[model samples]
Target: MSTDHQESVQELDVRDVDGEPFEQIMNALDSVGESEALRLVNSFEPVPLYDVLSKKGYQYDTEQVADEEWHVTIRPE
Candidate 1:
């Protein structure tokens, strides 16, 4: 799906979640628009998030930017 719609991809930098990444990410997901995607920045591979979001009808693509940094782009299926 094209993200050129009215709502652009919403980005959330959760590298500093401090043990509350799930809550932070869930909140961010709440604001995602139908045509928009959620781009998450983290310090590690958020393996659990993939499963959580998958169950919510979202799919993701991940890329490692550094040894300890990753970028995950999530969109509705």
Candidate 2:
């Protein structure tokens, strides 16, 4: 419905993060428990990141913001 509602009840913003592998980010989120994990990435290559994170048991959603930047939301399983 609303962005905030969608983010709170359905998602969480991981915030802008850079210079980290998708696997590493997933691993870190895993340790945090089965909550929503968001990753703000500064990479144009979001497909691979999405694939990798999604494969790790996260319901992944991605949005491109600006140049070489994206916001990825992962709901952990």
Q: Estimate, for each residue in 1-77, the C-alpha lDDT of model 1 and write its tens digit.
A: 54454657888999876776898888888888777889999998989888899899998999999998899999777
Query: What is the lDDT of every predicted structure here?
Result: 0.86, 0.56
How many backbone clashes can be found in candidate 1? 0
Q: Tens-digit lDDT track for model 2 on 29-74?
A: 7555453455545456467666666566677667787776667766
Model 1 regions lying over 4 Å from their true place: 1-7
TM-score of each: 0.85, 0.55
Question: In model 2, what are the clashing residue pairs, if there are any?
Answer: 14-38
